[model samples]
Target: MLTLLHTADWHLGAQLQGWPREAEHRKALRALVALAAERRVDAVIVAGDIFDSLNPSAEAQKLLYDTLKELRAALPAATIVLLAGNHDPAGRIEAPRALFDLVNVAGVGTIARKDGEIDAGVHLLPLRGAGGAIEAHLLAAPYPRAADLPILDGASEGSPVVRSVRALYAELIAAARARIGAAPLVVTGHLHVAGGLESEGAERRILVGGEHAVPSDVFPEDIAYVALGHLHRPQSVGRECVRYSGSLFPLSKTEIDYNHGVTIVAIEGAATTIEHVPLPRPTPCLRIPPRGGLARENVEAALAALGLGPATPADDKPFVHLTVAADGPIVGLDAEIDAIAEKFPIRLASLTVERPPRRETEAPAPAALRLSERQPVELFREAFALTHKSEPTSEHMTLFHAAAAEE
Candidate 1:
């Protein structure tokens, strides 16, 4: 049996933007490497989105490099293959392929239209490793442009751009299948195949008739297994032979519900069995709402009710949304709010204060008086006059006295 570990969407450079996720990501990576070692898979396939951005920070690069190195040391016998996802810049990712290749790490980012066959006791279709293949024909389909294909029948005429894209992908897939003639053929692609699950924060809507939605029938019928990337959700599309491994870590809050991990596949003869490996130490987040007004007392009470306090910091300074209703007129609410903020590592992403309705017994004050009531102009004038008492002049004193009187 040929055992393969399938994982994707590492998003190594991902940051929670002031939120703490570094530790969780590190934990997830360790779990993945451990899974690979424990399973002793013959090979490992990473679908795509290995890095969150093309130009990741130095810290991110260091983390990825260290993790990959550890994985290599742990699984010296297994072949590790990494495909390029849309989030990664092809050119930049390709630069490191050669260096990794020196250590039995096969990087597919640099190879454009390459095919390879492997012999792991089981006769594989592609013979040549990496870029060049020694099979009847091995086709490697990268992300294809949807605007280069022929138009569909119902597609509006004169929409050559749209039609060509559809036609191009069809031709690409058709051309790929034409070359495979049994012999346990396998194709690896990074495009979104039809009938795959999409995670939150994925590219908005795959093109209506674009390359993202290639029909499952496009793959060769004899193809042993199709390794797919791009989509972050693990799923079997059309046939059991085709599958996505999903992402290795949750990239956003939307993915928190998803079980971040890798898929283990055992390929014996033509049959394949897949098992999902769970990630370790998933990040936990809580969203708390204020029960009453945002007055200092109420805010403290709400915090206590939610079981949150300055003494007990959250596992991660939880993302908090604070809503308060103030009972009476308050002063320096900003400073009081800041004091509350200092208590926990929690960041107030949003703070809302709702004022109670005016009482019928309360008479409406004049606009001037109301403005003065909130911000006393007299206090500012007095402070200014005291500060410049040394330079007092008739004109200055007159201006200061007038300002004080108006207040």
Candidate 2:
């Protein structure tokens, strides 16, 4: 039996609303390592997006290495594969190749090629069990720039990029199948699959702009499993064999609905079985009054309905997003909410005021603003008035206008 742990989109060192997530991430990584140890898996695959930013903080880098070290220590015989996602700086991710090799951890960021050809030797890996027996073949397909998969002039069926991507994978899979010779096949990648669900707010929209999503048929049906990344919500493509493991934790408020976790895959011969293990939630992420905001009185009444009696420990406080309607008087609004919030054992992560329309025919809010056509000072004045509930003084206007003029 060949059991594997599939997880991705760690986004290590990610910050939400300018709040550092190192502590949460540290706990989560350690938890994953412990989980792997408990499961006694033969392989672990991290699809991609290891760091939140291309230039991650030193602390984030250390956490990743430490997590890998701990996982390896706990599961000495397992093969751990870490690939790069769109957010990763491929070169930086693969920089410690020699060191990783020494520790029995494999890392692939940029696609490896030899003399203008996809180098199967580097991309295709044979998974070995504790008895030194080959269990499966893995194709590590990292996030590819246009340069990685060059298009060829030939009989084509899909868009150039899609054709290119499909061609690349087909070649690698074919190579892997030939090399491994009748073993369970696992393909790992970081891309937006056609039917995958996305986490709305901050999860990177991998298919933004002109780029299109690849159809589910991109991978062969015979493959045992297709592990994916890029999307923050866990979901399968068109079939059960292809799947995304999702991010380790909710990265944005919109992602609260995500049943965050990892997948434990058990493969025997060519058959594959997957179990999604949901993570524990010590603190909750909630958007009060789901549809939208409510009137001040209504909001208070809703809070009362929650019936939270007293404040809890700081670490146990839930992240809250409060939205209130404010067409009428907003006097003592924050104070009133604060009193109610104090009773709820939740941190007010955000407070949004929904204002009623000024007039039935009020000019539609422009979809976007063009600062080049207007003076910067004017924009500042408008924003200041709305935020501070008063017009800017002459001194403020002069200082701001002068600064804008310099630009």
Cα-based TM-score, every candidate: 0.64, 0.81
lDDT of each: 0.60, 0.81
Error of model 2, residue 20, in angstroms: 1.3
What total of clashing residue pairs does each candidate reach? 18, 0
Candidate 1 off by > 4 Å? 18-20, 110-141, 145-181, 204-211, 287-342, 347-407
TM match of model 1 to true structure: 0.64
lDDT, residue 121, model 2? 79
**Highest TM-score against the true fold, candidate:** 2
Pairs in clash, predicted candidate 2? none
Candidate 2: misplaced stretches above 4 Å?
A: 154-158, 207-209, 297-315, 327-346, 353-407
- Per-residue alpha-carbon lDDT of candidate 1 for residues 1-407, written as tens digits (9 for 90 to 100): 57777777777777664554566668788888888888876667776677778787777768778887878888775666666666666665557766976875655553333243222211112423222333222233444434223445664764444344445545554555455534455566666667787775654344444435666776656766777777777677998878777776555545545666677877655666777777764544433452444556666655556555565545445555566665544447767876877665665545656666667885553345454465444554444433432334566568767977886
Model 2: lDDT of residue 75:
92
